[model samples]
Target: MTANENNTNGYLVGTTLERMLKAGHFAVTGELGSPQSAHGEEIRAKAALLKGYADGVNLTDNQTAIVRISSIAAGAILVQEGLEPIIQMTCRDRNRLAIQADLLGAYALGMRNLLCLTGDHQIFGNHPTAKHVFDIDSIQLVQMVADMRDKKVFQCGDEFKGIEPRFFVGAASAPLADPLDFRPYRLAKKINAGANFIQTQLVYDVPAFAKFMEKVREMGLHEKTSILVGVGPLKSAGMARYMKNNVPGIDVPDEIIDRMTAAGKGEPWFGKKNAEMTKEEKRARSKARREEGIQVCIDLIKELREIEGVAGVHIMAIEWEKAVKPIVEGAGLYPRPSV
Candidate 1:
């Protein structure tokens, strides 16, 4: 269908992200990490930085289980600044009651997009001693939120008195997660459970993701939902190696590592032994590798846009928020659509 035709159908025409995506615009969403302190200025600054470049900015919910300003508060801050915020809700820190209440509060705060997550374990954060409250997993959380929005009722089938939260529900997906063959089916379950859209884990190995998408297309899951493939800039060869070796469900091909290594060779410290290189020299090498990583992301986005079922690109420049504008422009996705 044509872009204009898709726009007129109007499944979700409220939030900028929903409008842009529904209008068949190649949508771009960026991630913003909430500060550990309740400094409202910091959140506003990040939101301002992403203003024109991204259709929406995802406010992480104590991402990695580390304590931070609440996603709902940060989202409210962004909304006040005229930026669209995707409030991420993780089940690691809250039970069903808190989750439902937060959803209601977020909607009242004018936040329209919700990204439900199953969150990292407490053991993975600074407060390992803290107890977890995984009363439900991500799938169940998505289902619950969908129920609240569509049925105007609680999980126990209790109806609401007045208004129900209107949210454009989203969920996370790790396409390269273990038992690769099952990843597609897992995604189908999320769709069945009521995910309106999906943002996947960072993707570096394109061919592997293509294979996964093939399975998804075979099942016609793509037609049932919108898929935003995750793309991010790698800082260095060392960082790439670290992610591949330590991070779960992330696949960084050997070629990308080699490319970063080759890019770093352009630095003055190329032939110098690691112990002999000065800190300045080391920093230059890291910068060169990061620049190369950005270029790689630009190319990846161009490639992903060609995939049949791929709906959009979620440019998660991680801590490098400034790089998003350049990457999006480089990939020719700039001049974001106006909703």
Candidate 2:
């Protein structure tokens, strides 16, 4: 009579990373950016490529309000490929009934992890013509999931004849958003709403993040919740600039920009130029970037982990999936768990 017995085949419910957080270990997770169109082959190829390197793949649901293949479809593909799938549930495109149906479908298909998001505005993405349904924000979505689990019923008023879902519920956070002082309050709200863990927007200011973690500890949330500091690899100077100037809800300090600028000016270490360098040079710089990224990553992870109540790390490499294993290894995380 375990709480998880209701889950589909007792597969690890909740995100693999969240399960790890609950178990008291630093966990690693990644995202699988869906293809722009119905290109299933391309999507499957991408997920297959990331299988061994990531503990779970978060299939974005119209991420940034961008219209793309559905997250459920992508989640199904990831599950079939032997990788854990985190079904990214956004309230932008569906009403409560649709949400319930989708969640049930995902569980039946073997998806366990759920990352609920409030979703981006439609105007920000390519699909301006699409209608949005933010009928429920992320907090309510978390509550809804909890209710379904505890009640063994769907929002659609249907009773389940079989197992209930044991979802490792997760929610998003942007530590740098709005008045800095208000972040802790927002986090408290999400936690109150049943968010088991959080994955933050890409963070650049380690000291600022450290301060935030301190506040989390003071609030006594450090041990009660798991916080994963998101990290995006800078593919080049331009990519770095784009993230700073264009990406919403991310703050990259002038110092980090200065470092990348300085690095850009230095001679290509190992006689490499741009992306066309020999495989060995490419490997070396990739290693060096991952090392550099991991150094910053480890610093934050160490500080974040030391926070009296903080649990594990979730490393997000974006399109640089190849670098994830190295970065995690570089950060000294061995035997990366499959779940």
Candidate 3:
């Protein structure tokens, strides 16, 4: 079906992320944090809840280099539940054959949107003891997928059927973490390497993001590929601090932190405590932080959407799926895209 008819039908058409990237207005998407364990019931329930509010849900594959269910497997489950699943495939845990086989399997199951990544090191995740796999990095992964879809055959001689996947493929980049002047160059390289779209790591500096977009425009990439800026609601000053200091490739500016600090301080709306807390107590104080975060995120999305070349926002609430609906609704985006 045509994209227009899919839009009129109230469901995203063509393919999941393909249609989303093609939306005229900025598209809004979200991720599903993998379950701590492979509890089918819990995973299923989260799928049901997030299905309504997000364009599609991204399933991480052993995210942060920790061991868990593979993203392709979890994606199959999400597809079975009638939710568009953007499978997050990383090269850290699999070789070319494993990755190719899984891609074919996902296509067979009707799951197509894929966010390819180099993945995190084994030392960073819950299972620090696990062995690492780095046979192919993300750019290589993108090229591999391009080869499969465009060529219709793997290096192993496995032939794929049906239309070439036409998978709406994306890769992760860190404009905020890299040297500011060099980000566009890096982005250009990735685009040339076969990245169809880019999902940037958490962005806190809107002006910096604007500059990055400008640089990308100068490279002429803005017109050729879709760019989705990643936004995570800062739950508190402490969490904001953590993002600034700990999250690699994510730069949280002092001004934004100050704004978050001032926005919810001592202002109890809806009868909730709103006191400033120290870093040690941020987790305990998250209730108030979350309230503040959602509002901040809604405002941020509004601002980010206004940037010249930004195609969309990727809202990642981490384990906060319940908050996604309210934030999106508060941001004036309801009846979320179903492509």
Candidate 4:
């Protein structure tokens, strides 16, 4: 389908990310953190950094429960900036009525992609005392969005008077997450609920991820929805180790940690801790770790590309937008394909 093509029939998702996946282009997507204020320029500045590096940029919805600019509004800003934004919606705060209302507004603003999420609890955000309103879960949200687009009706079964939003709906996955044996089944549930694509949590252990993909292939979930493996540059050896030890479902390998530690070794003030380093030394040290992180991410993408059931890579450098370009280019996914 042409980029500008619009059809009421829903056969064509028509978003750049959808087109790339359809044409087997090995899509690249990135995360753009909406700032914690009503700043359109912040979104634009980040768009400039990511414009040519990704097929679609995801504008997170009050990520981490922190209040921020709405993801849909950020998506509109991105559209104005000549970049495609994937508006993210979470079930943590809104009811069905609010969710549908925002989606209608998002489509009117030229947003074409959506990622349904069960957002972080209010305890994780600034509003610890706020009430939780998970009127629906992520799976139900996907089904609702798909229904609005394809079935042309709201979750209440009310028909759209003129037009319903056409979104390439997506759902998140944590392949290595516990009840480890049930992850694939969970993915299947999302697909059965009408997710057009899947974006996963950050992946560090390629072999473990590949095993998860093996089950995905067996279940044929990959054929039903595009799977974008998540990747990101490690900021430091400590970060890598921390994730491996603390982050649930994230299994960071020893070799990667060793490599991250090695990347910082032999640098200026090698023996000095980051806290004790001079400002200039800290800068140099950070630059080295970031470079190594980018390389490691690139290598992961290459390995993932060769694996079955993997359609793309989702680069999640939320606060570190500058890393997106180098990571994409190094992975040979830059100069994003035109739909």
Write the residue-wise lDDT of candidate 2 on 1-339 in tens digits.
674455334423555665566566677777778888998887777776676666678888988887788999988888878888878999888989899888988988988788999988898899888888889988889888866776677766576677777677788888877788989888888888877778888887677777887888789775666787777655544556778788766767776565544442354664455566877766666555545554555555555555455455666665556666666666666677644
List lDDT for all candidates, in order.
0.88, 0.73, 0.76, 0.91
Worst 10 residues of 1 by lDDT: 2-11
- Better lDDT candidate (2, 3): 3
| Cα RMSD for candidates in order | 4.3, 4.1, 5.0, 2.4
lDDT of 4: 0.91
- State the TM-score for model 1: 0.94
lDDT of 4 by residue, 60-102 (tens): 9989899999998899999999988988999998999999999
For model 3, give the 10-residue run with minimal summed lDDT. Answer: 4-13
Quote the lDDT for 60 in model 2: 89
Models 1 onward score TM values of 0.94, 0.84, 0.86, 0.96
Query: Worst ten-residue run, lDDT, model 4?
Result: 1-10
lDDT per residue (tens digit) for residues 159-200 in model 1:
987677878889999999998888999999999999988999
lDDT of 3 by residue, 215-300 (tens): 78888988877888898887777788887888877778887787667753664342244465455455444666677788888888
Model 4: residue 37 alpha-carbon error in angstroms: 1.5
Error of 4 at 333 (Å): 1.2
Ranking by lDDT: 4, 1, 3, 2
Which candidate achieves the best TM-score against the true structure? 4
Comparing 1 with 2 on TM-score, the higher-scoring candidate is: 1
